[model samples]
Target: MTCARIPTKYGDFQLCYYTNTLDKKEHLAFYMGDVSEADDVLVRIHSECFTGDVLGSRRCDCGEQLDRSLQMIANQGAGVLVYLRQEGRGIGLLQKLRAYNLQDQGHDTVDANLLLGHGADERSYSLAARILEDIGVKSVLLMTNNPLKISALEAEGIKVNKRVPLEAPVNSDNESYLLTKVQRMDHLLQFAPPSKPIKQRAL
Candidate 1:
């Protein structure tokens, strides 16, 4: 509905606020440089993660991915980050927190959601595609590990030129979570051997 210029450490961007009839939620488009008709525009379709993105929770890599995507877009000087409001993979915050408790009880991310009677990933890409089209993005070099995102966007008629991997740091807390993404979701990722924990010296 409105566009505003936002200056960040990485670069200045024009943030466009969008209100779509699909979900009628406030989605956003943060773009740097001219993307109105640019080919091979870099794009990242990010779902909202309140805990990870805001509080920097270590249980997942969502915060890192969000920051890394912004940095990458800044470096390119011409990219778009479609911030979708699909919190907790679209199960909403309440269900997500409950699922986290389930995770602590020894369930993987997917299974936790399934236990909550929700799909593994309830997030949709149609809103993201519409936002991209509204922003006039022609084709994109999508930064993601999820092949399903690429397919979903394409299915929604967004031209994906190539896949640009946006991997994040693996930590003790999120190790198994990332593994489930690879093993179950078919995300294109390879895990490095976990770093050994440092032992503290006796005082």
Candidate 2:
């Protein structure tokens, strides 16, 4: 593990980069304040999304969720945001782009992945559980809309005190994609519409 100070618009964060035995990909942890020995520390287990996160693409809500999670953690004064290198829901960039082309051709995200011979989401959280352990976070108030992420972390021995909804603004481009997540993938986004208040989900 290598640690460094990362200055972002949100605030100063201690960024730790890691190479784990679970996969060849390098993972990252960007945290603020003292998360060690903390319970109910806000956490976001984010999978990498090149288009949405970096390019600010509106095709999906990844960038918005990433930004929202960080701001939430920063405001809370103590939290961890884990960046898992699972691009495009773990299909890798090339295939993900291919899947996007399929999506453009009228297939939804899930069908696009299935057409490309991949699971709806191939990412794993064992590494995230390991990262939180290394960071000394006793338990977490996980920021996410995915219940599967909560279950996965618990399965890997990370205690989730509760779930904090990390939803993003709905837009025309991503509305269908987001709806697909709720309809097909079972992601909790009852507050997906712009008018609804952020709803909290208990673990």
Candidate 3:
């Protein structure tokens, strides 16, 4: 693992890179403060969402959640954000875009992925656990609404002291996507009426 100092709007962080042997992809962890001996350290295992995070797509709440996690961490004074390169829940960007097309044709998020011949979520948390272990994080206050994530990390032997819900306001474009997560994917998120205009442009 290699690390370098990174300055961001939230605060200064050390960006650590981990090279994956199985898939040969690189993952990153952005963190502030030492968590070597800390229990219940704030940690967010965030999967990469190119469309949402980079493009600001409103079709999913990923980007907003990422921002919220960082802000919360900054406020709390210590945290780690593990950025996994698992675009589209591990199906990669191309298939995710294909899934989006299926979604536009009247499919929910999970169904769209299934129709594309991929699991609803192909992401695994063992890599995240490895990253956390490498950085000496023992237990975490995991920032997520996905129970699967918490369980996956626990299965990988990373102790989760608590679940910190990461919620974002619904917009017209992402309402159905968020609903799909709650209903089909068993994500612990509440749905509300769209509170703002959809900022997503067609991909």
Candidate 1 global Cα RMSD:
4.3
Worst 10 residues of 1 by lDDT: 194-203
Regions of model 3 farther than 4 Å from truth:
192-203
What TM-score fits each model? 0.93, 0.93, 0.93
Model 2 regions more than 4 Å off: 191-203
lDDT of 3 by residue, 1-203 (tens): 78999888998888998987877889899998877778989999999999999999999999999999989988888999999999999999999999999999999999999998999999988889999998899899999999999989999999999999999878889988987787788888755323533344221
Model 1, position 188: C-alpha lDDT score:
82
Candidate 1 local lDDT, 12-122, one digit each (tens): 999999986778678999989889988999999999999999999998889999899999998988899999999999999999999999999999999999999999999
Once fitted onto the true fold, the runs of candidate 1 whose alpha carbons sit more than 4 angstroms away are: 192-203
Model 3's C-alpha root-mean-square deviation from the true structure amounts to: 4.5
Task: Arrange candidates, best lDDT first.
Answer: 2, 1, 3
lDDT of 2 by residue, 1-203 (tens): 78999999989999999998878998999999999998899999999999999999999999999999999988998899999999999999999999999999999999999999999889889999999999999999999999999999999999999999987887778877987888787899864443342243211
